[model samples]
Target: MNLIGIFGTSGFAREVGDIALAQGYQPLYIARDQTELDAWSFAGTAILESEVEIYREIGFAIGIGENAIRQKVARRFAGQLKFINLIHPSATFGQGQRQIVEARQGMIVCAGVRFTNNIQVGDFGVFNLNATIGHDVIVDDFVNIAPGAHISGNVHIGPRCWIGTGAAINQGQGDTKLHIGTDTVIGSGSVVVKACESHSVYVGIPAKKIK
Candidate 1:
């Protein structure tokens, strides 16, 4: 079986391990030290980051949820190691057939997710449980869509944006696309109907910027 090294021992890492196991890959916990490794009950062997060079055959995945941290780690190991995309088997495509969704490296797609056709997802994007992405949606790198969030068709989400749990982004009409700018945070339960500016926090119905 292929050995997959998961960096970070958080709950999300364990979740990714389960997905890796489902895909017939052996999951190894990668940590800084033995103490950090011991804290998490991982099924496979634990190895420190310094010892990672020894495992030349292993592929890695970033288990950190924060966009900045994930981006840093991804860049650090970019040329040195191969990053794996872990998509759960239960995720359903638009049609009945299993067609390929446009997902890039280090993406973590959870179970019960649904994707429509022509969806483009960038590197290291996280689609939480049951999140739905509609047709022709463009998701940039390091974007995290929380559980139960619904992103409509022709939506362009910029890099490092966080869509909180249950947030809904309205689709664009005709040739227009609703754009969520870079580094913006959409609060949980917010309903975004228009374009959002970069580096702002949007909340409430119709999604007004608060910060």
Candidate 2:
């Protein structure tokens, strides 16, 4: 049986392990130390980072949610192990069909998600449960779209940005795209209509930058 290693032992790591189980792979919990491994009730084998070389033909999925941490973990195993994209089987394509331009490694797409045409997703992007992504979207690396968030067409989300739960992005009028800058955070339930600057936090119905 092929073993799928999940890096991190948090609740999210367990969730990813369940996803791996659904995909028919034996899930192994990978931790930095024995104490971290002992904290989680991992049913399968728990191994430390130093012991990773013992396993061959193993695929890895980052269980960390934070962008910076996930990026760091991904870098540590890049080219050394194959990254897995864990998508729930129930997630659907827009219009009953769509074509993704590019979807990189280590993406976790949860159930009831919809992806429209011409979407480009970078590495380690997380789309939580029931998130809807519209057409012509560009999602950069380590971007997290929270549960039930609606990302409208022609929207560009930058790297390490977080779209909070139930947030929505508007499709900008004719030929214009809504651009969300890098390292930004969109608050929960906010409706983003215009372009946002880098390293800022935006909130409210119309999505104004507060910081």
The number of the candidate with the highest lDDT is 1
lDDT of model 2 at position 128: 85
lDDT values for all models = 0.87, 0.85
Q: Which window of ten consecutive residues has the lowest lDDT sum in model 2?
A: 94-103
Task: Tell me the lDDT of candidate 1.
Answer: 0.87
lDDT tens per residue, model 1, 1-211:
9899988888877888888888889888788678886686656777887888988567888887788888988888888998878889998887631334433688888898888878877889888889999998999999999999999999999999999999999998899889999999999999999999999999999899999
Q: What is the per-residue lDDT of model 2 for residues 1-211, given as tens digits with 9 covering 90 to 100? A: 6789888888778878878887888888888788886776657777887787777477888888788899998898888988978887878876533334124689888778889777778889988889999988889999989889999999999999999999999995677778999999999999998999999999999999999
Task: Report the error of model 1 at residue 128, Å.
Answer: 1.1
* Model 2, residue pairs in steric clash: none
